[model samples]
Target: MCSWMVSSYFGSILYSEMPFNVEIKAKVSNASQLAEKASQLSQSEGTVIHQQDTFFNCSLGRLKLRDLMDGNGQLIFYERPDCGGPKLSNYSISNTPDPEGLRAVLADALGVKGKVKKERRLFLVGQTRVHLDTVEGLGHFMELEVVLKEDQSLEEGEVIARSLMKDLGVREDSLVTGAYMDLLLEAQG
Candidate 1:
C-alpha cells in the first residue's frame, strides 16, 4: 500500500496580498502514462521543468525558494488545508533573478527545513495546471492547481478541479495533502 503525509503547520500560511486557488495533490502510479493521456486531451504539449525547492523554517507559513534550472526563481509563501483531498490554497509569489543570493539570505535568517528536487511535466487545461512529478527519493506524484480569478468562486474552482481529476485518471483514494517539502520532513521523522 502507498503511504501518505498530512500538511505541516507551516503549510497553512498564505499572504493576504496574493491569489487563492483550489489545489489538489495526488500520488500517481504511472506518471508517464498520465502525461501521455493529458497530452492527448490538453490544449498543448506540456513543458518540462527541473526545479529545486529549498524550504525554510518559519513560524507562520510555508516558505520556499524555488530555483528552476533556467536560472529563474520564485520565493513562494503559501497556506492551505492539510487534509487528504482537493482543498483551498492561498499563496504569494515573488520572482527573483538571483536565487543563490536569496537562498543564502533566507538560510541565514531562517534555517533550512529541507529541499525537494523534481522533474515536472506541467500541462495546462484551462486555468488549471496538471503536474506530473518525479521527485528525488520520494518517487512520482501529481498536482492540480486551479487558479481562481477575482471573479471566480472557490466552488467553481473545486468543480473544475474535480472534473480535471477525473479526466486525468487521478484516483481520489490516492490524494495527498501538503507540499513536497512536508513529505520529505515527514519521512525524516
Candidate 2:
C-alpha cells in the first residue's frame, strides 16, 4: 500500500498526483532464490508483469511511457539521484488507454532516448514494493521501493529499505546506481 493516492482520473487520463519513495536497485545473481525469499517474507505469491518502458528526453527528470502489453499503459515522470544506496525519488504517473499513440506523440515531441523491456515479479512487504526484474539484454536485478508517507521522514524510509535489503540478503557491493536505461546506453557505448 503506497501512501500516495494510486490514481485520479481527469478526463481520459488517470494520474498519481505526486508521491515520493526511498528506493534502491541492486544486481542479483539468483533471481529465483531472491523471489523465493521475497515471497516467503511477504507471505504471498508474487505477480508477474511484462513491461516495456520507452524513455523520452526530458529537460528535468526522466519521462517514460510504460506499456504493459495488456492494452494499458502508464506515463511516468520521476526524478531521483544516481547513487548506489537508497535515495529519495519524486514521481508522478498518468494512465492512458492508448500507449502506442502516446508513445508516438511523445517520441515526435521529445525524441526517444532508450527502452527497457523486463519481466518483473512484484511482491509487497508492508509498505515496500519488492521487484525482481529480469531485464532483456541487461540481466537480473532487484529493486526495493519504500513508499513514504506524507508525514514520514526520508531517514525513516531509508531505514526500512535497508532492513528489507538485509532480510533479502542483498549485499552493499551489489548495489547499482541509475536506471536500466542508463545501463543499456552504457552497454551500447
Candidate 3:
C-alpha cells in the first residue's frame, strides 16, 4: 500500500463564490493498479455516521503518523456520504488535530462558521469508506472514493482527481464546484 498524508477543507460559499476551508494531509499513494480497479470495490454498503457540531478551532500541531504540515490554511470538511452526486451531507468531525494542528488553528483564524450533520452510511471499499447523506431538508447525496495516488506530482494528482470523477460518472452539471458545507449554508438561509 502507498500513502501520502492528504488533507483539505470543505468550505461554505458566499455570493455564489468560493467557500471557507483549511486542511493539510500528505496524499499517500495506495498501490498503483488501485485506480484501475476502482470498480471492483463498488459494492452496495451501509453505515450510520456521526458529526460533531462545527466550532472555532485555532491550534497548531502535527500528526504522529505521516508528513503533514499546516503551512497554509484550508477549510476543514466534515465527513460526507457518497451517493448520487457527492454526499451533500454526512457525518464528519472537522478540525482534526491531524499530527499538524492546521485545521483547528486556521478555522478559527478564517472566522467562518460551519454546521454539522450525521447519518447512516451505505458504502465501503476495502479500507476506504462510502456513505449516504441528506442535508436536513435540503438534499440527498452519495460519494465513493479510493485513496489518492501517493507522491504523485501536482499535475498527476489533478489528473487522477479529474479522471476518477469522470470514470465514476460524476456529471459536470451536478458537480457543485465547491464543498457541500458551503452549499448547505447557502441553502439554509
TM-score to true structure, per model: 0.90, 0.91, 0.42
**Model 1 C-alpha lDDT per residue in residues 83-182, reported as the tens digit of each score:** 8766777788999999999999999999999999999989988888888899997889989899998888767888898888888898889998778988
Q: 67-144 in candidate 3: lDDT tens per residue?
A: 113332223333322222222221222233442354355455654356445343444554334334454544554444
True-vs-predicted CA distance for residue 142, candidate 1, Å: 0.7
Cα deviation at 159, candidate 3, in Å, is 3.6
User: Any runs in candidate 1 off by more than 4 Å, and if so which?
Assistant: 1-15
Preferred candidate (TM-score higher): 2 or 3? 2
Report the lDDT tens digits of candidate 2 across residue range 81-182: 676788777788999999999999999999999999999999999999999999999999999999998789877998999999999999999999889999
- Of the candidates shown, which would achieve the greatest lDDT relative to the real structure? 2
Q: Give the TM-score of candidate 3.
A: 0.42
Clashing pairs in 2: none
Which is better, 2 or 3, measured by lDDT? Answer: 2
| TM-score for candidate 1, residues paired by index | 0.90
Model 2 residue runs over 4 Å out of place are 1-17
Local lDDT at 120 for model 1: 93
